[model samples]
Target: MKDLIILWLSGGNDAWWSVLVAMGNPWQVLDLGAVLALIVVGMQIAVATCLPDRLWADDGTNAFFSQLSYLHIFLLMALTALAEEIFFRAAIQSLLVEWLHSVAAGIAVPAAIFAVAQRARPASCASASRAAPATASSWG
Candidate 1:
């Protein structure tokens, strides 16, 4: 994580805490993150409820989620988010940036890999929601 942050910042000087304390203010960063999270959650809720059924037709993905208790769902979502960030952002993307010497390549390569991975997953595996934020972060 520290190496990734140093590579990302391009200074090779920022400590690992820079990842946790963005812009030198952890509280402000957390507040902003919370707002963004709420917006994403609200958008998801709106999509699930307001979109036509045909838009989200019951594939095994729906069935997969429906079987899980709320606790399990939340835990899976948290774990998925953590793992994706660590792998896609901290590891793969960092290496791509260093190797390719291009930030755009760094972002696009992992996103393409992520899309491919998502497509390759079994129907009863992870949900598309788990990929949304990772994709967004890559392009954002």
Candidate 2:
């Protein structure tokens, strides 16, 4: 478990280091896709929180659709999807296979580690709720 966590963190650090060296600096590049992704994510959250009841209304659709015309959104989404897949599915999985030196071991180790990492938030949320006793007023 410790080894897997270490590997994951180190891999991320290494990736960032390499990216910095190769790209000279990420901020300098006009990453339209990232900007678009951020705008989309922010808008989604804003709509969900501020206008939850009307999110699916015609006006909401119009507002959301307008963002789609921005070229940066498409670029950001494509780059993000590609980068995530390569990092997690290819690079991390391949490294795990190399370290474990067995197909089953490699797959199992990384998969288990990945599952645990991914589920940490939900698991913690569940545990926290369970730990808190239900109150009559809250339930009502």
Write down the RMSD of all candidates, one decimal each. 11.0, 16.0
lDDT of 1 at 66: 92
**List of clashing residue pairs for candidate 2:** 33-76
In order, candidate lDDTs are: 0.75, 0.63
Q: How many backbone clashes does candidate 1 have?
A: 0
Writing each residue's lDDT as its tens digit, candidate 2 over 6-43 gives: 55667764533344346555573446347767999999
lDDT of 1 by residue, 22-43 (tens): 5666686677679778999999
Positional deviation of residue 68's Cα in model 1 after best superposition, in angstroms: 1.7
Instruction: Rate residue 75 of model 1 by lDDT.
Output: 100
TM-score of every candidate: 0.57, 0.33
* True-structure lDDT of candidate 1: 0.75
